[model samples]
Target: MEDRELLDQLFSGGDASASAWRAFLQKYSNLFLKIIWQFEKDRDEVMEKYVSVCSRLMGNDFAVLRKFPKELGLKSSDFPSWLVAVVRNISVDLHRHSQGRRRYPKALLRLDPIDRKIFDLYYWQGYSLEEIGHQLDLRKNGKGTDVNESFARILRMLTRYAPRERKATFPTSVPFNENMFVPDEEEPRVDVALFDKWLEGLPAEHRLVVRMRFWEDMSAVRIARILKIVPQHRVYAILQKSLQKLRTHVERNMASN
Candidate 1:
């Protein structure tokens, strides 16, 4: 069935089982698993999170689906993209929660004295880049550019030197229900491995912008606010350039093959 027909059936407010909810799950479950796998490399953890996402969407008579406004200028065709954004947010939240429970590695202590100070001020002290600039006397040329550059450098160093942790196993099983609908055939899947490889090859700033704009579904204004940058247009420019680079990379690879 078309997405529009399926959506109509869902929001028709008849019996809950009358809708295409089961079909919806079967169609999109793979996509959800793909998004979760990005943050969770372990197969077991990915499966666990995938089940959790289904539970969230299925609980309370599809409360999450009901939250979307019908008049929000979203068409039925936009549903998949919108749902992907929702899954991405949930996956990111889960990743953060799990990370919080893990022990802080001693590798953090190995940071250079100055980089450590900057890291602490920004992350631990909750200071914004502009504030950190003032505290560190890095407000060169009155734009806080120096502080931003320093913070980026520190981030790169920390990411490079962070100790890798082994994947943990978790026991999780999908619940059985009569209403569960399974797809007859698998949908064509994206080459996620190739895409991830290309994404990682981009410049750090470009990669960050791409993830924020696409995966996180963040507005340029919101991204600018988080990055302490002025004007949303800068974020848009970054996204455009980054996407162009990615497209070019893909084309070159395809030609070579």
Candidate 2:
């Protein structure tokens, strides 16, 4: 069925609604499992989280599914990106908040629940301060939760555990993983065999350009100069095509699961 037709069927409040929900579940189950697998290797844990995700979408008269305001200029082709986004959020929150708490500094542990959640969202989940500020501003009686002040206070509390360097506290300028906020778990996000499988499929030129561009951090112009290509625009074109193909290959693998 078309995207609009499927959505209409879901909200039609008619007999087909039941079947529509089932169909939706069936269609997206692979995507759901694929996303959850990024955070867990244990089959049982993955299944448990997968079930939790479906329940969250279907619960409360399907409130979460209905929350998408497709009327706000959303196109049909956007469905996959939107679905991936919402499902990714559900998976992340499930693993972070609902499944189990990661080891945190005792100082952060002593903070109240909201404070801890804020810290986790910022420190571990890598939410921007502005995002957290806006989020807290939406909550009831959350007017006092100034993100800067709270983060400053949390830093003071956690200072003892931080390294001697000044950037031990997460700074806005640095990348998320470059700091101490990286998750303790070593997530096997990809199967090396499968990864090599995709890499092996790439054309030799595309593979060489990808390695130079990413691994060596070479600019398109530099890559062109190095490879003795006449015009640099061709390098840009090749890089774009290579990335598109790589993304397509990865998504194909995910959907197959």
Candidate 3:
């Protein structure tokens, strides 16, 4: 069945919904297991996390499943990637729950300036590896650490941030490689009303990039295509420009106080 058709079947009530639920489980169960296993290598724990994920999906009559990006021009081809992202989130949460205690605010406060910047990029920028590589220049340092090793260490540092709400830092590209990335485990709520205030003052394109990329949690590439901005880099450019203004505004307020 087509992706949209499958969603319609699942979302609609009655016998069709039940059948679609089975089809969904049959289709994506393995994928869910794969993601869960990333957080835990033990088969028993993996199964436990997998069951937890399914329960969450089935909760409130499949509330999580209903959050499909259907309104974002979802295509059948895009379904698996979207599903993977969602599953990854659930798995990460399970992992964090096992890890015990949320200390993101404290952890963030303890980071050295350099490490803090790295966390910001990973957390807020949705930075692709290359962009982060450029910013941190992990390519080849005198230290004798390999690039992947260095980046992995940085990502390990990131596990501290605990995945509060991921403010939409729309990425410069595909963001991180999901196979290896460990995103925020959980995050405390942040009142971004101030940021939203600045957001309202942005130009149309800037506002769209910010709102779609960050607020809506849409991918940068997807936003580019949706906006029909050629070369895709234009989306990044506009986003960066918008962000600089917001940052400056925040800095100004802080300095005034």
Candidate 4:
């Protein structure tokens, strides 16, 4: 069955269909990992986030998925853009809550200057935008105003930050040489140049989704969390669309070569 049909069967109270979908995901586990890698900072976090997302999303319960990835001031096109947005917000929130009791944040990487400030105020300090704006204006006359505007802009930019999220991808993506259903334990080497060229043709947002879901092995629930305010169906749709594009790309590439 197709992913959407499987989802419908599961969502409409079919336990067998849900189990079938789970098996399908497990069978194509590598593809799911690729999808997870886009947002998670490291393999450890990726595993943690994936398990968390899957636990929340599977079964007949989609309450959290429904409410999470909250729909802020977003346009229809901006919905897919919200994937990384939601994940960043979740990371920030996780960081903040950890730091409250002087505990170490779960984040593996150090935030940059701007990200640090934004993380502090928005998540750690629990300050509102208007409040942040007021404080920025006080720190330095015109500079403070700029900071305020920057803060607002960052919020807006984050809402639509697609390409910037996956700018730090590590060396991944092996070629589809062997037509096997499962991944090889050892380095099953393949053509790197062809894979790179294929990756270049993908849309940024679609590419990010593919990397996260397929390469990184992230779960849809975690994806939903990162995209904090979006509906699960929306996230699923984005992923499905990306997969379709990728499937078509692969088919054409195979045909040509």
- The lDDT for every candidate, in the order shown, is 0.61, 0.63, 0.63, 0.47
lDDT of 1 at 3: 72
Q: After superposition, how far is residue 43 of candidate 2 from its true place, in Å?
A: 0.8
Candidate 4 ranges with C-alpha deviation above 4 Å = 1-184
Q: In candidate 4, what are the lDDT values of residues 89-208, reduced to their tens digit?
A: 444444354343421221202222343354345433445556654543333433322445445443333332332343322112222222211232333233355445555777776566
What is candidate 1's lDDT per residue for 208-254, written digit by digit as tens?
76666554445566667888766656776676566456556665665
Please state the error at residue 114 of candidate 4 in Å.
47
Q: After superposing candidate 1, which stretches have Cα over 4 Å from the reference?
A: 12-19, 69-71, 98-257
Backbone atom clashes (below 3 Å) for every candidate = 0, 0, 8, 33
RMSD of 4: 22.7
Structural similarity to truth (TM-score) of each candidate: 0.39, 0.40, 0.40, 0.28
lDDT by residue (73-134, candidate 2, tens digit) is: 88877776788898888998988853543322333334444455566556444466787766
Q: Residues 1-257, candidate 3, lDDT per residue (tens digit)?
A: 87768878988989999999889889888989888877797999888888899888878977887878444777668888988998888888878765654223443433333444554564444464566656554443443223354445444332212223333232233234433233444453333655566678798888877676655545567778898988887776776666567556665655676
Error of 1 at 165 (Å): 28
* Candidates, ranked, TM-score: 2, 3, 1, 4
Residue 189's lDDT within candidate 2 is 27
Positional deviation of residue 16's Cα in model 3 after best superposition, in angstroms: 1.7
